[model samples]
Target: GENVGLHLPTLSVQEGDNSIINCAYSNSASDYFIWYKQESGKGPQFIIDIRSNMDKRQGQRVTVLLNKTVKHLSLQIAATQPGDSAVYFCAENIMEGGSNYKLTFGKGTLLTVNP
Candidate 1:
């Protein structure tokens, strides 16, 4: 959750439970969004994405929810595990023009799954 415009930045969750991470974007012209899991010494792994036409989309053990009214996005992870401990990030796809867009990443939140 954001407190006074400050992001929580870190989230701690117990293993076998669910974890929810939230993010807020500043652009209203964003056309799409994505959730990614950062890999060690590698680029972030794509998890899920939702188009502007859709508000919710589900992936294997995760879900992405978009609140256009508030320009908010969230990722829900089920059955949190120690391996799930990593920094997650949300990216917004801004459409600059036809067939041309750029990705703007929001701040990352470090999720710690406690065993």
Candidate 2:
């Protein structure tokens, strides 16, 4: 199949440090957003999400910021760890024509943890 999506090439961080990952979305019509983390050889796992009406949302050690005006989204991870090393993705969901909706995902950013 033809390829689709986009992502950052890589990111490097030190253990116990904070890591910030960024993503740019293309669709202004999107109303929902989600951030996901995927370890090697594993499926993408949900981290946090923010609605288009909101600007920021926080989790245990993670935070998601949405800038609808710029169509930009960012994820911040506190206390970076070896286990936190993984690929992160941002996905957007948009609804159209009442029942017609689609979900699109970013290419993903590779986060490397250094001791």
Cα RMSD to the true fold for all candidates:
4.9, 3.4
- Cα lDDT tens digits, model 2, 1-115, are 0121124578898899999999999989999999998887778899999999999999999999999999999999999999998888999998878889898999888898999
- Provide the lDDT at 35 for model 2: 97
lDDT by residue for model 1 over 1-115, one digit each (tens)?
2221235388899999999999998889997999988744566889999998999999998999999999999999999989987778999998776778999998788898899
TM-score of each candidate? 0.88, 0.90
* Local distance difference test values of all predictions, in order: 0.87, 0.89
lDDT measured at residue 27 in model 2 versus the true structure, 0 to 100: 88
Q: Which stretches of candidate 2 lie over 4 Å from their true place?
A: 1-8
